[model samples]
Target: MNQTSTECVRVDINVFPTAPPPPPPVVGPIPEKLLKIMRKYKYNWRLDQLSKPKHLEKKFIAEVVEPLKIVKVKLPKLDPEKEYYADQQSIPLIRWLVINKKLYGKQNGKKYRKTINRYINKGWGSIYNFYKKRERDRRLRQRKREAKKEKRMPDFERFTKLAIPKRLFKPQSPTKKSPAKIFSNFDRLDVLATPKPFVEEPVKRLGVNPAALTYEPTETVIRLAQIPARLKNLPKPLEPGKVQKSALRYKVTPRIETLAVPKQRNEKAKVDEDYDPWTIPPNVLKYKATPRILELAKPTERS
Candidate 1:
């Protein structure tokens, strides 16, 4: 049996592969939503990855940076959960990349990363230099904007010149007026009589002498005097949105009554009124049994 053989023929066509749709123009103004996110994070680009060049190339280094702390933020828009724990001190760029990944996938995330990189690579050498220069440029831009706005505004002078009256311009003759009238009754006359000298006189009083009079404070006055002390002990108002700490509660214990006994003393023995403890022998002093030491030592040994 003869086997039929088939050979495939190669054909060449002049057709060229189309280029990708320009990568969606990465070099353009960042989205307002992204800028809002940056503002929330205070435009903090100080990240571990941003600090080192080796970390820049690593795709997963900036994936999940450890935050300074985790805080629960309230989100009213979400249906089920009212609040969610969010990372603090996290890089805004990383958050954008994450959001893009979840919403648009890896390609969009890469584009966002490139945009952030472009912004970061603006100034001379490092991220710090870039941020400094960016801040200076922003200040300069704000100043220029203010200057332009002032230039556009109409000149509103606070004190404007008033029009001179036509009557004042015309020459007028000076007129003479009669002298002011002087009344003899209105004249200030010097007092010819001098004031009488002060004289001491006997004061008449009803039975009680003025020197013996005393003042007694009323109940209201006493209460007013205690107001300052009462105010010091008053409970302070609780801070807004803060729970006041509960006051400590002490447990009450029953009091045990004990029979009182008279202290014992030897009357016959010649008691030394001047027994110098400092001059006593060292051995005796060291082993001396005092009431306080005996009382304290009672709890040491178990019966």
Candidate 2:
């Protein structure tokens, strides 16, 4: 037999174009002032790696530390009397700082976890308590406003009101002790005239009107009224033979036959009773889990 030989074949494919060269790193040496601030305020970690330049490849001096410097410079100028207000003002800045630190940690392969946690635990000061106080104050102001609105004066009365002065009354007057001689209402005054006899007026109503007594006809009554009172000719009675023929013509037809077989005596009644339309057939159905359905179908896992 001829000697068998194997040779490797080479193939080259330029399906994907070569990617462009990466931009040069914009990194610079960490400033002494930035390092000092970081040490003082505890802004970031990996200070030990400052001497080892490789670990400080992605220094977050501009993104993270610069804002802290600005805040430090402005802190003294802000009024200390409104300390809470100043703190509230710094909320957005602190939140942004924390978020940037987290992003930086992620960029450095999560090596600076303490930096993120420190900012979250230390830098974010009493934010939840501050919001709670604000909400409480808002509710109190709302209640005060509602009460003030309630206490507001109403519109002036339409009728003329006279303010009777106490000076108009005479002290220890004989007329004040005596009963009034004049009666304002004539109906209540006693007179020498005899009582008049009751007389019925023709214009005055004695009973309810006939039209008012009667109710308006309903739709059913109006529709029934349109029908003739009497028929010109009465309908003939149905014959027994014709009625029988009509019943036979309209009788329901027999059910169509089905090819389905009846259950055998050997088969269990549960087979037909438990049949679900939604269930997949056993022949083609698949269970893509460990221990199939037996373990999963249980209410609690086997001990």
Which one is best on TM-score? 1
Candidate 2 whole-model C-alpha lDDT, 0 to 1 = 0.61
User: Which ranges in model 1 have alpha carbons more than 4 Å from their true place?
Assistant: 1-126, 156-200, 205-303
RMSD of each: 38.9, 32.0
Clashes of 1: 0
Counting clashing residue pairs in each candidate, in order, gives 0, 0
TM-score of each: 0.19, 0.15
lDDT (tens digit, per residue) of candidate 1 on 32-121: 986676667643345323656754463555567677887889965654332221221223444454465566655557766676565444
Candidate 2: where are CA atoms >4 Å away?
Answer: 1-78, 93-104, 109-112, 127-303
Tens digit of per-residue lDDT, candidate 2, span 156-183: 4522243343456558656556776875
Q: What's the CA error at residue 31 for candidate 2, in Å?
A: 54
